[model samples]
Target: MFDEGVIKFSCEWQKTEPLAFSGLETLMGWRDRIFAAGLIGLYPNGIGYGNISLKLTDSSFIISGTQTGHLLHTEPQHYTLVDRWDIDRNSLHCTGPIKASSESLTHAAVYTLDSTIQAIVHGHSAALWQQYLNVLPTTRASVPYGTPAMAYEMGRLFQEEGLAQKRCLVMAGHEDGLLAFGETLEQAATTLLALKQL
Candidate 1:
């Protein structure tokens, strides 16, 4: 049986200042909508953990910032735009008042795998996650979130499970973690919600 005592990956992250500036107004708008829907909001237990991202260009994407203690309440100034990346090296370049989400590298890996993806939604919902666990492509449970290994695991999914065509993933390692991406913000967000209906 699997044991939580046997944690497999590190949680440490490497953060840096962005070398380029990218606006986040649109990203924020989508975030507000998602937050209001509770897709990335605080629970009755006073806990919240989730993120969203928007592809900026060929080499960058903007992701929601860290410790969003209250996803729905965080201002646009708190969002982060990753202007550059070196996922293989677990390095990132971005600018904003707050740092990138811990899953920034994982998001970067997705973008690196498919240039066509323009938006991403990372939500946490246990019921939807378990209900569709077998229906969607998933990462191994041994790989933890926000680390280089987790990032590579995401890239591996794209290669082995037709993720380029799927544009979504259920992270087996991270409890309740689900990911969806598409050519536009609406598409990605829709995909995420569609998972729950499945």
Candidate 2:
């Protein structure tokens, strides 16, 4: 359930049709790859983190569902798929076993910033995030993830600073939070992967 300053989306999409994306298979493949690399799973104490997404339309995308936890490394059936997440008003608008990624709004803002961005890969790595500050554009140190403020920051990065060209940023306030985006799943995934090689 995502909160908009106007209204929450928890109950608005109660009864929804299944929305599918042509890139579902590829997105899942990338999710698994990131999971295998320990980029989209849990921490040492067991708190889960990270998510992945693929654009479906100008306003919609497919994302890994919420509370995914370690299930990300398990079977494909255990991996929940979220479709038709609307960023304009903040809602899933689709019926699924799991909820949309808590960071759906952030992803939506990226698509809104550039229709050319077809994929987004988000992960947590304190070491990598810290190292990439000089290599990437980053958000302010007070913005929280999954909120409208973060979305607006993303827009500011693109509109004012032209972050769309780089398509990556570190959520300074959201611990270890790092995000990469591109014209395809591989491009976004590779951005995060590039940090590993660094």
Candidate 3:
């Protein structure tokens, strides 16, 4: 069940005008289109797909909505804020209206683990997911999604597999999904798009 109030709040936040970055906006737009196209192509059979999320300076993050499909056709504000946990504001108790993607915690975790990471992207692709699952036994237990436990597991995996230095991993339970993060949105989006080719 989607909460209307949260949606409205998130929409408002996204609508708030900001200083323009024509060059960055142009690049991000191109990245979004490329990433979206790659996702669509990878999921041609259409089992699942992925989207991008970005962390701005004010602690608010821009995340694509749940089940929005790829990223190309979606409106800009369709990307909403997953609240920043403001410790001074009784963060845990302060639940605002807009509901971010169910995997918002994953995005949050990446930023929390590394302040340098400005963007994160998660997606579902058949080959990549299959390869990840096939290699899971060689790694530790499978990586899950949509839960705090999974986020913790991912953190552990990052440290153990030396993926902390890298910016991506495959979420086994999500069925064809991969996670990628980077110092900038373009880097993350580019990595995600390239992973499909590798």
List of clashing residue pairs for candidate 2: none
Model 1 Cα lDDT, one tens digit per residue, 1-198? 122112222323334443234436666777776777666865555655778888878886777777573755656656776777666566777676567777788788888877888899888778877976757899898888777888889778877888877778888888778888999988888888776566
TM per prediction: 0.82, 0.82, 0.69
Across 56-172, the per-residue lDDT of candidate 2 in tens digits comes to: 777667677665646645333333344455554555554444556678778878887877899898887778878876457788877777767788889877876568877778878
User: Candidate 3: which stretches are off by over 4 Å?
Assistant: 1-31, 38-48, 85-98, 132-143
| Better-scoring candidate (lDDT), 1 or 3 | 1
Residues 1-198, model 3: lDDT tens digits: 122112111122223332233233643474467555565322444323465677775465766665455445655444555555532221221122323565666666667777788888776667766766534321233544555555566667677776666567776556566777788777887776776676
> How big is the positional error of residue 184 in model 3, measured in Å on the Cα after superposition?
0.9
Whole-model lDDT, candidate 1?
0.73
The lDDT per prediction is 0.73, 0.71, 0.56
Q: Candidate 2: global Cα-lDDT?
A: 0.71
Q: List ranges where model 2 is wrong by over 4 Å.
A: 1-20, 72-92
Q: What TM-score number comes out for model 2?
A: 0.82
Q: Evaluate model 1: give its TM-score.
A: 0.82
